[model samples]
Target: MASPNMQIARNARTRVADRVTSKVTDALKSDTAFESGSLALSARIAGAAAEAVLELPAEARRTLTRRQAELVRGVRRLVETFGDERGRRKIELIVPETVERSVGEGLGPIVPEEEGKHLLNELAVARKIEDWAGTVAGASELNRDYGIPRSTLHRWQHANEVIGLLKGTKKHVFPVEQFIDGRPALGISAVIGLAGSHRTAWLWLRQANPVLGGRRPIDLLKQDRIEEVIETAQAYFDPQ
Candidate 1:
């Protein structure tokens, strides 16, 4: 066998040759140049560029590799979190449902003014739902952690005001920190009642409250200060 240095030199030559050939072929196909004799000049320029790329700084290569790894991790998290029933439901919510309607029923091509309004409304709704879902734990994860049936949790979504509605999936998702020791945290339902939606309630619960000495309302609720937290939530929605 040839020595390692010889093998490396051979491989480098092969790569340079490939780049040059490809560039020349592309130039001819485009027919941008009048003379086919310019192929050699184009090939040489392409080969030089390829060699410069191969000689890029080690730090540049490391940065590129790190960025690629981070991108892969981000995509994986998105798939795991939103690629389930919830994601599908969210898609449905954003996409307007087609209902068979007569021209008299205000069902036809959307006018310019109405189209913009409709799009904005859908975007606002999608953002609210996505924000809530991001803060909550999905049914599958909660069920696995607490041995609660998915079906039962879903029923609670309708029965309890503390459950937030998600657009994409039919699954019921609750705030990840809403439960402690497999039991609902105190004051969640009361706050939900005052705030009208779980998203609004969650925002209030998470924010610092003056009455609680600048501590998050959720922290106070976890400490069994249900009445105080509920009062804070009320004040949050309606201040005297």
Candidate 2:
């Protein structure tokens, strides 16, 4: 039999768990996109799923075991988050560099064949995005070429004032075009916010937009044509 003190502790833990559950539910319920059936909705659901799975109960374990398909979809939703138009990046690289031999070589022993294949494909897509980010340079190169301090650069990356692409295991590569006059261009942050994620924003900035009269947004940013670039980005990402 459990002692009175032990029972009290258990009740306290249960109450805490209940409160956490309520918060997660309320957050999603109050969201405007809860019923939108958009990626926004999917993202919120994935986050809520993660929080629910964190609960200390047999139901949480059962969720992992019984609702495996939902969990897989949640994984995809989480992956898609790396490209949020709000300019969030330096996301962890969970997949290997190459998909070749990734399956039967090692993963087959663990992940199911179908699941392994899907994981590798996602990895390849991520690598392609990294390539689109252009030839990246480390902090030393950026500082030497741009004359900026490592501390300041790190702060900019943290604040999304500068685009920082996570390339390898734990290193980040910055796009050279993002800088002008030894600082990030005036509209880089805005473009990122309007465009969504670092990968998409960088890709769009590098491409010549017809709306910008065939001028790349990055070039316009360098030239301080911020209004044109922001307008273009807004239309491109949130076209009515």
> Can you give the lDDT of residue 158 in candidate 1?
62
Q: Report the C-alpha lDDT of model 2 over 58-102, residue by residue, as the tens digit.
A: 876864664453455457667788767776567787998867653
Question: What is the lDDT, from 0 to 100, of the residue 128 in candidate 2?
Answer: 51
Error of 1 at 125 (Å): 11
Candidate 1 residue 65 Cα shift, in angstroms, is: 59
TM-scores of all models?
Answer: 0.44, 0.48
Q: Give per-candidate clash totals.
A: 7, 4
Regions more than 4 Å wrong, model 2? 1-131
* Alpha carbon lDDT at 188, candidate 2: 83
Residue 234 in model 1: shift from native, Å?
Answer: 2.0
Best by TM-score: 2
Model 2 clash pairs are 84-196, 84-197, 85-196, 85-197
Model 1, 1-240: lDDT tens per residue?
999999997688668857776776676766766366566555665576556546668897666444543333454565467536743543335645877856675666767988889888888743554453445667787789787677777666666634565546665467766677675676777888888878677777777765566788787777887766665566667666
lDDT measured at residue 226 in model 1 versus the true structure, 0 to 100: 72
lDDT of 1 at 58: 86
Model 2 TM-score?
A: 0.48
